[model samples]
Target: MTSAQISPRTTAEPTSLTTRSLAPDLARGAMLLLIALANIPWYLWGAEQRDLSQHPVDGSTLDRAVQTVMLIAVDARSYPMFAALFGYGIWQLYSRQAAAGTPHREARALLRRRHWWMVAFGGVHALLLWAGDIVGAYGLVGLVLVALFIDRADRTLRTWAIVLTSVLLAAGVLALISAALLAAAGADLGASGQVGVDTGVAEPSYLASVLDRVVTWAVGAPAQAFLTGTIPTAVLVGILAARHRLLEEPERHLPLLRRTAVVGIAVGWLGGAVTAAQHLDLWGIPAALDWGFLFLQTSTGLLGGLGYVALFGLLAARLRRRERGPGRVAWALQAVGKRSLTSYLAQSVLMAPLLAAWGFGLGAELSSATAALVAVGVWLLTVGLACWLESAGRRGPAERALRRLAYRR
Candidate 1:
């Protein structure tokens, strides 16, 4: 089929980072803050009693509060939002190419080339910085989607999304129930323990870190990120949503947006809050609450992600009517979102030195609240930098390079 027949005749270029949709960009900027908040302090847990992947059980009330807030609003909540946006961006790239008159085969080739490079960037990010690298997983998922579903019909996308969502929820519920039963029967199988100890996410030698990152990328990219179905299902929703320009034209779909935002946020918040409270055992410290685990993750991933997207879409519509609502901060956040990839990597670059043992090792000393504050500071620094870049009419370093490689221009 010819390029013209393949895509809507939208005048705006999806790849034009300089002037993309404010809603998506704004959401991306906000999501990065949450990502930094959720991930930065994750490495700060003490190695003595608490697990590497969990908050220190012995935190003060303030630290506990910080931990609880992150669990309810940040943690697994950010990833699916990111995944959905990634999917939307993928469609944007493909449609942009088609609109620009590239043949179908050529556009697909370009996407493949771009994604493989993303995988390399992800690998480099993992090896040099954090072991919890997600870019590799995203790149892997993007490639598979391109191969399997990019050209599918809307009905097909919806069907697959629903099927995957069902499967994921079923698996999580089964796993949660099994773990609860095990815990009741006096098995410590689900006890939170040191996870990233061997990984570079914990204190490790350079060589050990490299090995650990490689192993983590190998396992997490192929297995945990995509196979769990959260990412894939979110991606499918993004694709179908893109076809209708749901986020782009939110006013046209206010009813859908409002209902989704309400239902999604409520469900997500309830599940996440319960999970946090159970873990904290605010009443009293008891045995592990295995039942809360799966519900927290799955609900936030599916429901929280949708809520975030819809909420931002509604906000964006209202802001447009107001003509730059909360002007300076909104503009700054949009700028940061425009350079999201660079901003995302910048979080690790700034925080690793302060937080990881491989560097200055502040993570060993900082309280949870302090770490979260530092993360916010780091995100702000990037926002300021992004605004400066925006004024200069320059793409962020990573975005510039990625575009060049993707388009060979």
Candidate 2:
């Protein structure tokens, strides 16, 4: 169908607050906390050596403990969850358009427009504030996936998801075998690369930091979206789950949700624990095996992310059965989730200026435990801001801007 065939009146408006589902928003709200935890470690710039998890190799007892927990639960896990939610939201937009009688081509066009704007938003975000911006990666992923598979059959989606997941798993196994062989051959595994570098965070000059962040983001964003099997795999699975309305109608799929939560989390945590042990030197693993451990952590992270989704679905189901509505804490989290883009970007605004060397340079002083506290504080402040916006019946500034751009009359 041609674009002219679909009237502007037939375009689906964004989902109103009342019509929104709880599970997805709740998952996103909670996921932001994980995102904060995962990101804050990078700002610990004074560490001489960081492990594959981007955590410092040496710390006090409490710091090590915090790192251990974060490695096992937060690292590599949060992004996949967000990616799955992003994919789910993409389907939601397309399905809403179809319901509004938007032609397939027009619906696709609307999505592309939004995704392109997201890429632009991400680019600006990286250039100005944070190097580890994920918005562009997700936007790029959405563009490709929507173009290629939005109209594909359910079976086709499932087939591709499986194929991609298997490929990731095979690569992980190969890395493990290769690591073992190299170690046996007396290779120096300690020479393997660290997971992250102190490029932008450690640069004392603001202009230099901006250059570093942009260059890192330019290289990292596309690589993250396409090269990392974790994201695409989770996104495809999310698309499949959205087809079944898994999160929207969790009560109908309690058994499936339960099994997924149990099994996925178990496998995910196990993989992370092994990596954490290696990182802490508890396993006495050779440095050469670091790559293998990283592969294992990343591959299982998709499962962990899906598991978190299922857990939130269950939580929503429980909330639905309650006589009273969700409590204030839950309400606040939902508020933040509703304006997630703003909250996410606000995190960078609050953090980079306070922690980076170009700003207050607090990152050089904070330990793992303290850094985690700072991350939580930043998230809480965003929550407060979101709640205020919620009370005023206003959208986040970022959300409003994107909506204005993407849904132009």
Candidate 3:
């Protein structure tokens, strides 16, 4: 172990677009849509909030339908997928450094710096636009996980992942059983008014709203990353997947991808459907059991998120078989994925003004269906921006900035 071996002459450079894998990018590009859908609902400030629900209590049939579908497919599912991908990206970065002859300690320090910058980015994002920002949460988790587990053996990663997942499952089960028992005992556990934080989206004052958003972000980021158990668990599994180059070489793991896609999506959707039923009052579920349903949905969300990742991996494999390569739509989506951070922040940029009460306050005037249309439009706009950047051979501004900060000697 010579000093030269311990410290490479130069650190690894950022990955070039040409060398980037298709599956991860494609998955990211597509999931931004889901993230849009999930976040936009919080902007509907004029609508009546329900206990244990992100959706408003009132809407048209179409709005209800949209809400149902979103609950079943989007809500808790998208972030975990992003978390998995984030973890995978971390591993990719760390490995690239190792391959470039950087020592483990130095490489870890580089990643720590990057993650800290991400936290800063998220804080600014939350303060300026959306309070429900995920960047900080993922960054926070990345910092801890990289320091603790980045050098751990494969078996250790797997063991910890399993332990975390089991804990989530057990928590879900206990919540359900306790709720049922309380309901049977005739405990008055009905709707206890609206749940969730007031993130100043509905506030008429911009300065006041800024305070609200920052406060919400400060509390929610840590709670989401650590307390929920979903993000951390998914992140661990993502590290394991990256270790095997699952996304990078999807063709080599067809059977596993296919099985995970099928089973994971099925279970995730089933859990979400049950929660949706309760939300819609279609199942006549006791209000006492609201937390139970919520727990079930969150617990199963990790699988749903991973299922989406596997599905995209398979899609990437199919694209590889094409003679002309991916079509225009695939290329466009990949562009957005390549510039994902910019595209993601761009959603807040586009929507906050039009929808927030401090701005034009369109959220007060929109229903679920309309809000969804707005989200999709915002996403499409980002797609176009990403495509333009791709054509110009320029990285997204956010990406370029982060790279400069992270790679600074």
Candidate 4:
């Protein structure tokens, strides 16, 4: 191939590992840590009560305190960051695929394969371990993103961003109108449909629930996919961020990042407050009795997600300004981010033995506070393990496998 035919750059700044942000690495590491941390209380609560009603699990005053902090800090931000990162990765991957002149059909096939694998992984996770699986949802949405970008070779990623933003704004308006109409009609609204109460253990077998979930996704996922619009939005944002080298050369982007942060916080708070109000139980079975719970989820997840992007970007800018040393902690976090899948799955599998009824059965036994502490311990351990693996090799096992499958090597 002619030198001029070389693929367009995909990654932010230099398209090399050395130039990439320690921020995305550190941010992703922090995200995985929070994911594990967030799961513990939720797990313990599930053990104590079969249904997921309120988010803040009831416990001792100490547990209550910890739960409150988590609700304010981690819960408000983590998953949104995670989802945004997912979008960023999609941008990086899809752009690279495009630069290669890979046919749209071929690229789409790869995303489909990846999605199916993730669905399988989610199935196993739900059946054997827990039911709150995001991987499947992420994968399902990711597939749509792949399709959207595949044939858009002539368009810049910035254009995609505008399109995504417009769509989100439109969806938000539509959802708000729907909620208002339902409220005016005195219609009882819950997260899903008018359904059974959440009792936790008596809810149903994991298998049955997963089967139902799979079927639901088959039918309803398209609607849900259209509703959230996160995947496409994320891809657009990520591409713009990458093209501008925002994630890499922080000095150049600090001014824009700061502005985004300020705006995001203002908008996010307004959105979060409205969404949070829809929940009858901030700490109880919120999905069941609350009117407009789904509406809240749609709104909050988007608003909070935007806030997280700004927050992380701002934090990264600050971190970059410090000219910090490459310490063990940094190394550990970078390692974990590089191979997040292994750590994520490891947490899911490891948690089964730690809290499941079939194992130590410490689910309900541990308070939310203790669960949070345990989550910290687990995060630290995972960090150490990731560091060790990175020292020994380039990729974590899962990362390697995914790459091999993705490239069909």
Candidate 5:
């Protein structure tokens, strides 16, 4: 093969761990930490009232304080960042496949195989370890979008991204407005929908926790697919960003990045704060009725998430100009990012036994701040392990298996 033909293929294949960017990997690594923090609450089932929510309504002052902080910045913020990264990563997959001169039909078939496996993995993860599994939804929506838009033009990609995102956001804005009208009319909306386990278990039992997970997973899977449009919209944005060379070449798009960071973050923080206030009873709203707040985040989170992407891109540009490559921290994060699938699953493995009622039974005992500290410890464990694996020149077990499945023999 000519050098020209070989060069692109050599760099495009991410499965080989070549041609990776620091910022994307860093973003993924940071994203995992945040996801850990967000997801830990799902495991908390106490020996008390056995009620589950994002946080205990009757938590100590510190727990309430932690809940407010999380609601404003960390809770809804992390999902979109993770979703955007997932979308961006898939684009890398498709592009590399094309660059390798694989035929359209074959490439698509391979994509299908990878995602279906992902679906299987996600299904297992949700049922066994955690019910808030997003991997399955990403894979499901990914399969649909890849088939629909892989061959579409940049113009069409942008249009669809805008439209889908707009639809999701509009729904949120409408809901918020309606809720305001209801409040004005003194209508009692009442507590609706399950925020957490909500199993009504008075004391923790292994069997009860298992039952909770099964029921929640069964319910969450369908809600994840249809409720928010979070997956497909993020995927579309990733496609558009990839086509425009947004994250890959950030310095050239300074104005765009600046605008996105400022506007998206401002809107996101505002909406999130409103939700947090209401949830904390600062706004005198029932904490159980978080659907309104969920809508607020759902509407604005895409912007916040994309803004984070842009902000990270700008940071990457600075890092590139300053040094030859990343430092020790970046290297550690990249290691986890590179093996994101495995690192993510490892958290569940580590935490399920530590936090679950079926294991250490720490869930009922710890407060919000303490639980978050535990979450950080869990993430740090993975980061340390990822660094060791990187030093040993090893791929994550899940990543290796996934490549074998996706690439076939």
Candidate 6:
């Protein structure tokens, strides 16, 4: 098996900063914003209250509206973007190390260093503040993927693409068949089943509980990120995108991207709608709703994730053509992308003071609307701060630290 080696490149370019890739930076930044917005409502609720079987947001009309919009448009979309970008970053890292003529063993060491850096950062992020640690998950899954895919990149990517496509198709077909059978028997989806919370009353201080839960998730999230959500889908698709040079030189594949985007939009919307309808509380638990949720995730993951990638890729290509001048928003987003880890951690750190029950105790009080509004403000503040840092510094603190670690002393 070929070990994953870092890509080598001339350091003269130093920043590799360019306006061409601005769209992805902007889109990624926007995705983070949406993720934060969507999560605030969840944050307000204690983890103990997050039972999927029960309606988490079932109070006011506004709550339902937010839940509907997030599930339909945002939930499955944001993390995939984050995961795809992570894969892209990996490819770039490997490419640069390879170019530098770093020996294969040394290069592989560098990749491991980078992964470790992410793990360390993730630990801090989870323990100090936020519980939702993507980097922890990314580091773990990335180690596995890098080991499995490095030697035969082409083969690995192809196998993943085929496997994911098969899984998605199988799930979708099974869902439709189940729905038809239920309809024949005159089933309903809106019915309820017995569900309850069983929190063993340890009842620690709010901060202590948050920290404990975050620690547990930080340790285990990598496997779940790969096996459970859209991370696998994103990783497979990211490999495809990188191999095709979709991010670096997408102009070469603009036509294919455009066509895929079109198809993706149609299929994603239609399949998602059908999947959503299956959850009308008709047949109860372990029936239409449960099975339908699984298929819905697959279909939406395939269609919406790919659609967003293509759309953004096309936009990036267009921006490249229009002139290489950096727009303010684009520049700010690029800063966030450049030091993504710092910005990501910064959000979680900022969240602690805002969400901890020991603080405002808003951890379980705010309405969805209030949470969203506050999240947007935080995102704006982050963007502005990132832009300012980029103007004065070469890279975000986290980015510089990781690079130094990867290169080693």
Task: List per-prediction Cα lDDT, in the order shown.
Answer: 0.76, 0.87, 0.89, 0.59, 0.74, 0.63
**Which 10 successive residues of model 1 have the least lDDT summed?**
4-13
Query: On a 0 to 100 scale, what is the lDDT of residue 382 in model 4?
Result: 77
Q: Any idea what lDDT model 4 has? A: 0.59
Candidate 4 least-lDDT 10 residues: 5-14
**How big is the positional error of residue 217 in model 4, measured in Å on the Cα after superposition?**
8.1
The most accurate candidate by lDDT is 3
Model 3 alpha-carbon miss at residue 111, Å = 0.5
- In the order shown, the candidates' Cα RMSDs to the true structure are 3.9, 1.8, 2.3, 5.9, 4.4, 4.6
lDDT of 6 by residue, 1-409 (tens): 3333223332212235443366557667666786676556545545323223222524476765665565556655667667777777666666666676655555556667678778777776766665566787777767777777754667778777678766776777776677567667777666433333211112236556665656566545764466554676677667667766787777898888898788776666665555444433433333434554655555565667677777877877777786756466666767776667777777766665677664556656666666667778777777777888878865667777877766653
Reference-based lDDT, residue 222, model 1: 76
Q: After superposition, how far is residue 350 of candidate 2 from its true place, in Å?
A: 0.5
Q: After superposition, how far is residue 27 of candidate 4 from its true place, in Å?
A: 1.6
Superposed by TM-score, candidate 1 places the C-alpha of residue 122 at a distance from the truth, in angstroms, of 0.2
The TM-score of candidate 6 is: 0.82
Q: Write the residue-wise lDDT of candidate 4 on 1-409 in tens digits.
A: 5321322222112133344567677768878987887667655635333122234424676765665556444553456567777766665665566576755455556666666677666655555555556666677777766666544542566676666666665666576566566656766554453223221222335445455445544444454345556544654566556655666566677778777767655655555455444432443333433433344444445555556566666666666566666566666777898878778877866775677554566765777777787888888777877888877766667667765555455
Instruction: Give the Cα-based TM-score of candidate 1 against the true structure.
Output: 0.90
Summarize candidate 5's per-residue lDDT along 1-409 as a digit string, tens digits: 6533433334334465656767778888888998898877665665232112376566778887887777666776777887777778777777877887766666667778788898888878866767677777777877888899888898898898788878878888887777666666777766555444543222357567666666776677656755687667777888777766777887888899889888877877787788777766676544344565678776687777777777788777777787567677878888999889999999989988777766777887787889889999999999998888899988889989887776664
| Tens digits of lDDT, candidate 1, 155-255 | 88999988887776677666556655665676545555444434465654656768877877777777646666788778888878888888788889889
lDDT of 1: 0.76
